[model samples]
Target: MFFSVVENKSMVNQSGKTGKQLKMTSYLAQEVRLARRHEEILSQRSVLLQQMETYLGDKKTKKTWQTQAADAAHKRNAALLNDIEAAEKKLQERVYLLPHPDTVKLETLYWASVEESLPKWEEFLLGRAETPIGFKKMKSAKWNISYPEEDSQK
Candidate 1:
């Protein structure tokens, strides 16, 4: 469900942004929206199925028309299931077309940034420094605190 967009060599050229980039961006943006839509469709299908089950399981004496209604419900459910399957397949295809991010470079840069900022954070925590500019002071309750157990061997 996590969508990351990295420039694919095939999709980009030396000059500027290409149509493929725009298409990829559009698809990435649509991915979440589409996923939510799929979930809604699934929910609708489930409700329909539950209703059908309830109707068919009723203890009342079966009327001639009840059988026809049940058959129609079954047909509609089958059609919905088919649509869901097709949508899932299409989603998979769209995901397959998405370019994967360069995790190694990303991780390296992330760690470098963290390393650069660690000293400032440590100084602030130690009370020797004021709250760093551009950062708000968070409540103590917002922090997760854990203490290491003392070694019994010691």
Candidate 2:
């Protein structure tokens, strides 16, 4: 006796055993690559935005900064000019105050005359034997060292 069994082709089930698994892995790898590329592009854009913001911030302050600098320079120049004018005026005043030798000699002679001609009554009234004579008081006291004609000639 001989026996035979015929197999049915429809009895096999794939259930994603081999070929589908390879395809899914390949798709996951492609997705990861795309995600990394997008992250790199977003980072570059953020860096460019920060640089543009810095440039724009400086542009907004341009006019006021230049005006302040010009004002400071003008003030410095004016102060320097005032200091130079003051120094020139001081030099001129010093030159005017300098006493000539002839004027000093005449002044000495006038004071000597007043010292010699002091009366006893005037000395007693003032309570001091001698007093320092200034130029203003000497002129008012009729003390003269030169002739009227000679002074008029000068």
Candidate 3:
């Protein structure tokens, strides 16, 4: 009896205009499925973009973002070198002649006289009798050594 009832139910479900309605409903289901697929792709793209943004926002990546950092460092180095060179030029420009008047005038009265200037001048030019004039002597034989004969023989 139950089997007969189930067969009757199936017969009615397959009958009349419901078959055409079912076909239309299946078409709508396919459309909905396609729309859902598009939504899933868009959602995945959004998630990927968010992940990329987060990666770009990291401190190290943000700070050292490009090869231009090396260029900027090189520019800074060049500017600093130019500044150092300019400062050295200014220092060289102000360098005065030897017997730098300010230093010698304050230390000695030798520059004051007019007539008896020869001996003080010689002493000043030739250095004191105690310390001979010329290049400093090597503390040890750690450097090349050479001595020229006295100019009187030449």
Clashes of each: 0, 0, 0
- Candidate closest to the true structure, highest lDDT: 1
Over 1-154, each residue of candidate 3 has an lDDT whose tens digit, in order, gives: 1345445445434346344455567879998999999999999999999988888787557577555788898899999999999999887776643557767886566545543555544665576543334436677867755557655466
Q: 17-128, model 2: which lDDT tens digit per residue?
A: 3444445568789889989998998998999899888877777677678888899999999999999999999989987897778998999999888677555336645876
For model 2, the stretches where C-alpha displacement exceeds 4 angstroms are: 1-28, 55-67, 100-154
Cα RMSD to native, each candidate? 48.1, 15.0, 13.3
How many Å off is the CA of 65 in candidate 2? Answer: 3.5
Q: Rank all candidate structures by their lDDT, best first, as comma-separated numbers.
A: 1, 2, 3
Residue pairs with clashing backbones, model 1: none
lDDT of 2 at 115: 75
If scored against the real structure, what TM-score would every candidate get? Answer: 0.27, 0.37, 0.33
Per-residue lDDT of model 1, residues 105-144, tens digit only: 7887899998998887888889888877769878998796
Q: Candidate 3, TM-score vs. the true structure?
A: 0.33
User: Residue 106, candidate 1: how far off, in angstroms?
Assistant: 99
Candidate 3 error regions (>4 Å)? 1-17, 55-79, 90-154
For model 3, the run of ten residues with the poorest summed lDDT:
1-10
